[model samples]
Target: MLETRSLTVRFGGQAAVDGVTCAFHRGTLTAIVGPNGAGKTTYFNLISGQLRATAGDVFLSGARITTLPASRRARRGLGRAFQLTNLFPDLSVLENVRLAVQAQAGIGLDFLGLAARHTALHDRAMAVLERVNLASRAAVPAAALSHGDQRKLEVAILLAMQPRIFMFDEPTAGMSVDEVPVILDLIEAIRQDRDRTILLVEHKMDVVRRLADRVIVLHQGRLAADGAPEDVVASAVVQEAYLGVRAGDV
Candidate 1:
């Protein structure tokens, strides 16, 4: 459903994301794993339009979207949740998600014609909030929520958009142990939908193992390994270079 052909980006003489050519199909969750600075996030930036690639192309479904800006790509069905929470601090949590639903439905911010749809939007936003366990905090300003809640809110917004392709960059990065399960479970549920595709950048091997149908490893800005999670995780190069462990140990 998505693909990157020779996708690359350079910072001066260093290639942050080398020529990476890969395709992702519907009904699969692919976990991107590598050590710090392996260009996992850089690769994501290239695909999500955060960083324009130095060369190559990004294709959504079948057409090239390399020239499209991030917002356009999003409108074309690419949903991204960054490592940092992206929110409107001044807006209430419900408003934030409501706006996302509004966008997905192609409604303008102008609420003049929104009377008939307001109830529907609110119901959809509340449903997403409830899914993320944030319904009780619906009226709280986004900035007032805790860090974990903020991350969950981001996920809620992503869910509201209902993008065809989901990209999560370290979704559980700063959450407490008690809060991690919610996001993971949510992702697992999304995985069950065969029409959708998911790309996750997670450091937790256990999480990758549990949720990913496939795993791809990046090393020094290049695609080093791609295969079933178990095979890639146990490969000699991944065990030695990426994980800093021997094959036997892994």
Candidate 2:
């Protein structure tokens, strides 16, 4: 449902992503894996409209969105959750999600009513929180929640927007053993919904193996390997570049 055609991103004359071409299809979760500077995140920035590409094009459901701004992309059924938590620290969990719902509804003009006071908005926000398994923390200040909760809150905020394409950049960055299952389960549920194409940029091999239907391996800002997860995992280049050792050699 989303595609990047020979997409390249250059920063100050340094090409961070070079002629990278890939497509993310509906009903499938695609994982982008590579070395630290492999340009996975740069590719995401290009696709999400966070950073304009130096060349090539980005398309969403067949519509060219290369020049579209980030907000416009969000309005056009693209949802993104960053590696770091992006939330209103002082706002309650429910309020934070409500803000996204409000944005989706184009109700940012209303200010007199408390965000939590809108019953419909609150219900919708709660539903999103529930999807992330975070509904119980809805009344707490965002800053007071645990680190894992904060990550879930980020997912909830994106879920509130109800986008057709979800771009998650390191969704399970710093969670404890106890917290990992919760996050993984929530993501699994999202994948099972079969409603959107998910593009996940993650470092955790276990997470990627469990969640990705296909894998694309990048190395030195270029496409090095692209195929089923097992094939990519077993690839010689992928093993040397990102997987820490040669496959079957350890």
The lDDT per prediction is 0.92, 0.88
Which segments of model 1 are wrong by more than 4 Å?
109-117, 245-250
Candidate 1 versus truth, CA RMSD in Å, comes to: 2.6
RMSD of 2: 2.6
Model 2, residue pairs in steric clash = none
lDDT of 2 by residue, 43-125 (tens): 88898899999899999989999999999999999999988888899989988999899888877777696765678887898
Model 1, C-alpha of 249: deviation from truth (Å):
17
Candidate 2 Cα misplacement greater than 4 A, ranges? 110-117, 245-250
- The sequence of per-residue lDDT tens digits that candidate 1 reaches over residues 147-227 is 999999999999999999999999999899999999999999998889999999998899999999999999889999999
